[model samples]
Target: MSEFKRAITAEDITRLQVYSDPQFTPDGDAYTYVSTAINDKNEYESHLFYKKLNGSDATPWTFGNVKNSNAQFSPDGKKVVFQSTRSGLPQLWVLNTDGGEAKQLTFFKNGAVSPAWSKDGKYIIFNASLDHDDDVESQKEQSKEERQKQNEEKKKQPLVINRLKYKSDAKGFHDNKRNQLILFDVENEKFTQLTSADTDHGYQDISPDGNFVLFTANLNDDADYELINDLFTLNLKTKDITKLTDGKGGYHSASFSPSGDKIACLGHEFAYKGATLSELYVFDIATGERTCLSEKWDMQLGDLMIGDTRLGQSTTGPVWSKEEDRLFFIATDFGATGLYQVTLNSDLEVLYKDDNHVFGFSYDPHSDSFILGISTPTNPCNFYQLRKTSELVRLTNANAKYLEEVHVEEPETLTITADDDQEIQGWLLRPYGFEEGKKYPFVLEIHGGPHAMYGQTFFHELQLLAAKGYVVLYTNPRGSHGYGQSFVDACRSDYGGGDYTDLMSAVDYVLENYSFIDENRLGVTGGSYGGFMTNWIISHTNRFKAAVTQRSISNWLSFYGVSDIGFFFTKWEHGLNLLDDPAKLWDFSPLKYAENVETPLLILHGEQDFRCPVEQGEQLFITLKHMRKQVEFVRFPGSNHELSRSGKPEMRIERLNHICRWFEEYL
Candidate 1:
C-alpha cells in the first residue's frame, strides 16, 4: 500500500467526476463519451471525449463549461452529432471527425435531444417538445413583444385543471405540449415535423434501411389513468403508421433488429404492479408474435438500483449482434449490475460479472467488443473496454489521482436470513484506520425506492461516515430489486412489517459477527423510501441514538394525493386508492406512530420537492416539535426529490455537512 492517506470528507464529493453515455464508432476503431465534472462555479459541466481502440490516450473533442452529451457517430463515421447547451439551450451540433468547428443543426423553441442518425446519414432525427397548436415556423415568427403579451394575458386567466396528470416533480405544471419527432435533412438544412399527435412520442430507433422509425406512445383516450406504452412504426415514404405492440403492458427502450424484421424492448406486464421486474421481449414485425426473452431469468433488467453519489445512467441499446440472432443488455443481479446476453434460441449468459456497477455500454458488432461506463465502491466512474476473451482494459482514469490521495474503505458483504426466512443482502464498511479489537460507532444507512437496491456502487455519504470513525452498514431489504421479483414485491403493502424485521435482522447479524461495532451508539439515516424507513424505525424502536430522514414520506394518506405519481403509485404499491381505505393508508404511515419517537431526529428535505412533497417533512417535523421531542428540520431552498444526487453542488455539500454534523452531535 502507498503512504497512509487522509480520510475522505464531504468536500471531496465535489471533486468526483461522473462518466456516461459511451458510444462506439461504426468502424469500431474509436469511441466517444461524456465526462462531467464540477467547475469552479459549483456547476456540473459535461464535455465530449474520445479514444482510439488501439491503446491510445483519450483526448478531449469538445471544451467548455456548458453540458454536452448524447453523442453518436454518423453511419459513415465522418461526423459526430451531439446535444449541447453551449448555445444557451440544448441543441444539435455536428462536428466533423477530421477537423473544424461544429455547426448548429437545430434551433427548436423547446430545444432538441436524443439525436439518432439515419442509415444513409442524410437525415438526423430528434425529439423536441412543441406547442400542440403551433408549428415551429409560426412560433419562431412571433415577436418577443407579442410573446410577452400572450404570457401576461395567460397569467391573468384562471388556471384550468383539465388533465388527470397535471403536475410533475421537477417540472411544476404539465404544459399543453407534446414531444414530437422532427427530421433534419443534413444536406438541405430542412426541418420537417413528422407527427402531430397530442400524446408525447418517445423515440426508439430507426430501421436498418432507414425507411421507418419506431417509437412508443400512449395514444388512448384514457391515457392519463392507464399505463399503456404501445410501439408504433412511422413509414418514411408513405407517411403511414403501424402499431406493433398490443395494449397489454408498458413497453419502452425499443430497438430494431439488424434485419428490420424484429424489435426487442424492456417492459413489464403489471405482473406485480410497480414492483414488477422488467423483462426483455422480442416482437416479430412480420408475424406479430412476441416472445419473452428473460421470462425465466428472475432478475430485473436495466439499472433501477440507486446510489447516493451519482444519478442513474440510462441503460442503452438492447444492441443486437451482427447476425441479429442475439441481443446484449444490462441486468441487475444479486448486488451488482452486469452486461448480459440472450438469444432467440432461449440461450442466456452473463457476458460480464463483477462486484461493480455497469452504468452504460456500447457494443460494436464489427470488433466484437464493448465500451463500458463502470463504477465501484472506491472509484467514482470510468470507461473500460471488454473483449470476447473477458480481458478488461481501462480507457480513462478520471478519478485515479484524487482517489490515490484519499482512503475509501471497502465494504464486506453479508447475507443474513430474516425472521421470515428471507435472506437479506447487506454490506458493512469499517472505519478508516480501523484498529483490531476496538469498538466503533455504527450508522445504518438505508436506500430510497424501498424498491431500489443498495449494492456494489460508489456511495459518497457512506464513505464520509466511515471516514468519520463510524462503521456504516447498509442493506437491501424485502422491497429491494436485484433479488427476484417475489422478494421485491414482499414489502408492497407491509411497509414496516417484514421489511422492518429484515433490516433489524441485518443489524443484529452485523453486531453478532463484527464485535467492533458499538451497538449502543448506533445512528440511522436515509432519503425517500429510506427516509420513510428511518422515520419508521425511530417511531418503533429506541435502539438508535440519532436519525436523519430526508425527502421522506411520513404519511401515506397525504402521499396518495400530494406526490407526483401519487394517484397511480399509491394504488400500484398499496392496492388502495385514497378513497378505497383511508384508515389502511394511515395504518402503514410512519406519522401514525410518531408520538412514540424517542430518538434525536433530524429532518432534511428539498423545499420544491414534488415526489414526496416538502409538506411530508413539514408535517412530520411539526408533529415531533408539538410532542416536545428532539427534532430539527433543514430545508433546501430550490431542490427537488433528487436533491441528494443531482442538486446544486454547493447545496449538496451543505446537505452532506448537515448529515455529518447531526450524527456527530448524537452518535
Candidate 2:
C-alpha cells in the first residue's frame, strides 16, 4: 500500500494546534502547557495539558471551549493558577494538579490577568482594570448583561478626548478604567486592592519572601505624552512604594534575586529612541543602585521573531538563577532567538541556539532542565525538555497526526549581498509537488514590524502559498531584529532608501541563483510595515504582476493623525513629525506614487484598525481606481490590525482564501 498525504490548505489553519506558555512544576516532576485550536464553531479553544517528566504521555488538565492561559505553578507545586475567560471575561482560576474541580478566584468587573503566586502560595498577585471612582463592591454587584447594557449606553454618548494617547489597537478606544493591582488571599477568599493610581500598572514579580511586589508604571504627570515604563517595588506590609528606576528609561521583565537583595531587569534609556537594544540591568535593593549588565552585548534581548501562529505570551526574562549569581534570558541574534546566561560579574554564554523559534520556556533550577516551546519551519510548536548535556526530549506530539496528513515544505536559507555590500538573510520555499525544469509562479512575502524579523518559523500563509504551486520568498530587511543593533536600526529615517534596495537586491539574487522561479509571474504581499513595503514596491517597479497590501500605510501625513501610535511613531521612524516636513512625509507616502503603479493590487484593511487606520487603504484604493488601474478593496468588519495573526477564526480563514483567490486570479 502507498502512503497518502495532501498539500496544506488555507483551511488547515483551523485544524492546526498552537502550543505555548510552557510551565514546569517546582520539583520538575511534571510540566503544563496551553494548546489552542479553532473548533467547529469557528472560535478558539485553549486548554491546559499536563505531562509528567518521567516520559509519560500528556493529558488534558482543563477542558471545554474557554481560553485558559498564563499557567503558573505554585511554589509548593500543588496548585496551578491561570487566567481564563470562563466567566464571560478573563479572570483568575485555580486548579489542583492532583485532579479536582477548578475554582474561580477573581470576580473583578474588568477581569484580572497575569497572576503570580506568592512564595508561600497563600496569595496571588494580579492586575485588574477599574475606574478610579468605581468601588470593587459595586462592580461585583453588576452582572455581565447589566455591564454590557451600561457599556452600550456609554457608547451612545459622545467621547470626550483630552489625552494624546486615547486609543489603542488592542483595547480600542480608552475608557475611564485603569489597570490596578489586586492581592488575592487564597485561604481567606479575600480580594485586596493594592495600587489605586489612575494609570495602568504592570505586575512583574513577587519577592521570594513575599514582602514586596515588583511592578512597572508611569505615574508622572506627563505620562500621557511620554513613553516610559519605570520600575517600582511595593512593600506588601506597609503598602509603601519605592521607585527603582530614574524615570529616564523604559524598564520591564523584572525579577527578584533568590536572596531578594538584588533585582534583574531588561530595559533601555532610549539612547536611540525605539531602536535601542534592551540591556540587562541589576538593581541593589538596599542602596537603590542600578548597574547595566548587558551594555556591551550588541544583541537585542527577548523573542523578536514574528510569526502568525503564536497565540499566547512567553517568558522573555531576566530569570534569576537558584544561586543568584547568574540570570537566564532569551535574546534575538542572527535570525534566531536563543537562550543566554549572564552572570552578575558580566560573564555571558549561550545556553541554546538553533535554527528554530523558542517561543516560550520554563526553567527548573532543581533539575537544571528547561521546558521549551519550540517551532520550526515544518512544525507549529511542541514542548521539549533540554538539559545541559542532553539533547531535546520531546514531551508532546500535538501536531504529529496533522503533520502525517499534510505536506509541509522546509525553506532553503539564502544570503544575498545588497548593492552596498550589506548581507541580507532570507529563505525560499519551493512549491509543493515541485519538479525540476518546471517553472512556477513566485510570491514574495514581507513581514510587518520593519522592526520585526521573519526567521525559521512555521507560517501558515506562506505554506498555503507554496501548497498552491508558488515558490515563496521571505527576508529580513535591514530594519528587522535579530541582526545587531546597527543593522536593525539602519532602516530608520531612510525607509525607502536602503531597505528598498535590500529587498530588491534579494529578488535579484534569488532570480539569478534559482532556476525554478518564474520571473514573469511574480507576486508581492505584506501586512503593516510589510504592507507599506508592498505598496512601495508596486509603485516603484512594475516587476510584480500582483500585489496585496493589508492594514498598510499609504500616506504618512494622514497616518500621523489617525493611527494610535501615529503621533509619535511618525517622529520616531521617519525622523520628523508631520509639522516638521509635510512634503517629506508626502514624498515617502506610497499614495503619492499611485499613478506609477501598473501592478494589479488588492487592498485589505480591518475596519476597526486603529494602528494603520482603514482610511489608508481607502485612499490608496480610491486613487488607484480613479486612475482606472486594476485594484480591489477588502474591508474586514469589527476586525483590528491583528486580523492576520489573532483575528476572528472564520475571518482569518476568509482573509486567507481572499489572498489565495487574488493570486490565483492574477498570478
Which number leads on lDDT? 2
Q: TM-score of each candidate?
A: 0.97, 0.98
Off by over 4 Å in 2: 1-4, 137-142
Candidate with maximal TM-score: 2
Candidate 1 per-residue C-alpha lDDT over 1-667 given as tens digits, one digit per residue, 9 for 90 to 100: 2137989888886788788888888888888877788898888888888888777888888887888888878999999999998876788899999888998887776678899899889989999888877675543423457657877998898878888788887777788888999888889888888888888899899998999999999888888878888889999899999988777788898999988899999888888888999889899988999898887888888886577666435455587998899999988889999998888986998899799998899998887899888889888788889997889898888788888899988889999999978888999999988989999999999998877788888988889999988999999999999989889999998889998999899999998999999989999999998999999999999999999999999999999889988998888888899999999999889999999999999999998899999999999999999999999999999999988888888889999999999999998
Candidate 2 residue 513 Cα shift, in angstroms, is 0.9
* Cα error of candidate 1 at position 135, Å: 1.7
Candidate 2 lDDT, 205-241, residue by residue in tens: 8898999999999999999999989999999999999
* lDDT of model 2, residue 276: 85
Give lDDT per model, in order.
Answer: 0.87, 0.90
lDDT, model 1, position 368? 85
**Clashing residue pairs in candidate 2 (N, C-alpha, C atoms within 3 angstroms):** none
- Report lDDT (Cα) of residue 530, candidate 1: 90
- Model 2 sits at a Cα RMSD from the real structure of 1.5
